[model samples]
Target: MAGCDVKNNPTYLLVVAGAISDGAGRWLMHRRPLAKAHGGLWEFPGGKVEVFEKPTEALVRELYEELDIEIDPAAVEPVSFAQHDAVDDEPGIVILLYRVGEFAGTPRAVEGEGIGWFTVAEIDGLERPPLDVELAAKLGRLFPE
Candidate 1:
């Protein structure tokens, strides 16, 4: 059906995610709510970049909304990115991963999602979403075992 032709009417989403690490080398991870996309899967903390908002701006807002943390945009350092094609009927997504070098306030799950701090050795064991899996690999290289 022409209406089902995603190639002709593709939708692109810009999603921003953060890897907030403690100085001791542990990262904060968020588990997607069971009712949300990739339900029950673990991921970096962040959300969709709204129109008219920069990715860093969106990330700062998302961290506050999802984790109750206030992060300075200047503290976010671009680390990696992933481009995923459309799956099933869903639109394609481009996810940008940033390292949160500094933030004020402790992280707490404010959006009903599970939260945990994981070390590089512990990351491989977590059931992370696809995008997060890629980001983790890159992160692992930065802090080899």
Candidate 2:
């Protein structure tokens, strides 16, 4: 709801997600806390873009808050994006996914059930939110080897 309208009516939301890769064919993913939406499912670490923040800035803040890491905005590369239209009372959301190969500090699950590194194949086998499923597919396309 960070980018929601004042009236709280359905509004388009801009979300940012990062694919933090270890450069060894593995990427970091976080497991949602059991009480949260999509609980127990793994997804990229990120959050909504605040009203006054750029997507990269939002991603930096979100990564620090959720993963205990510091990322240089310049080091992030746009890889892919996935979006869903507004439906009923649900707000439409667009997730911009970035490839983050460099960062400071180890990633910890500061606000989730846990964190793990997985290859694209392994990630494809894990339980994930619908949008994450789409994002992962697009991520796989980034490396066509």
Candidate 3:
């Protein structure tokens, strides 16, 4: 273990994201708040997966906390995933995006700057975090025009 630089030993983070659709061709994205990392960037709504928590469970909780919406865990399905390399002091992050077609309550940005529904084409043009950029591209592939 000697000479093993802890800083260089990238700490990978597990994050869960949701691709919520409004029963249309539009998908929901959340604008991060100005004070947080990747601030003001639009991303699939999600958050870190806590210890012992499954990715889907984390997504369900995150959506509720961030958008004031309740989603069924059983209804969630995998869509795509994106990874961001560690830069400087930040840890590397791997985000798992899930798609949820049904939910209770209207979505409103409870923690972020805002929330909106956009087509995959429109999402590709929006500013997003590095990992989110990858996720958007994958979405375009999944639901092509």
Candidate 4:
């Protein structure tokens, strides 16, 4: 065990995010709370997948918790993913991005962060994490004009 120091290394996380789109083509974005990691950056609405929970299950749970909305698991379709490397002491994360086309209730920022709808072009200018930036690019390819 020459190089086995698990305690010194950050753990990996499985993060599930939704590219929640209105029927008209704009997608939802959530601003990270100032007290959280990646604070002040825009990200797709999602959160970490808990143990024993599937990715889609996590998406539904997270959306409700963060946005105060209900997402039907069947309404979410896997679209793309981003594998982010750990930086500094941060944990590496594999983000699974889903396209949520149908959901109930309005998206309110229950976590004291900003929420907004943006077109693909508008998303290009937002301050987002690298994983979100990649997810946005994939969205552009999926719904090109």
Best by lDDT: 2
Give the C-alpha miss distance for residue 125 in model 1, angstroms.
Answer: 0.4
lDDT of 2 by residue, 20-139 (tens): 999899999999889988999999999999888999999999999999999999999999999989988788999999999999998999999999999999999999999999999999
Over the stretch 24-90, how does candidate 4's per-residue lDDT look in tens digits?
8799999999988789899998999987899989999999999999989987889999997777878
- C-alpha local distance difference test of each model: 0.88, 0.92, 0.90, 0.90
Per residue, candidate 3 scores C-alpha lDDT tens digits across 91-114 of: 889999898999999999999899
lDDT of 4 at 108: 93
Candidate 4 Cα errors over 4 Å, as ranges: 1-11
Where does candidate 2 clash, by residue pair?
Answer: none
> Against the hidden reference, what TM-scores do the models get?
0.89, 0.91, 0.90, 0.89
lDDT of 2 at 69: 98
List where candidate 3 sits over 4 angstroms from the true fold: 1-10
lDDT of 1 by residue, 40-73 (tens): 8889999999878999999999999999999999
Q: How many backbone clashes does candidate 4 have?
A: 0
Candidate 2 runs further than 4 Å off: 1-10
Model 1 lDDT, full chain set: 0.88
Which window of 10 residues has the lowest lDDT sum in candidate 3? 3-12
* Model 1, runs deviating above 4 Å: 1-10
The local distance difference test score of model 4 is 0.90
Residue pairs with clashing backbones, model 3? none
Q: Count the backbone clashes (under 3 Å) in each candidate.
A: 0, 0, 0, 0
Clashing pairs in 1: none
Clashing pairs in 4: none
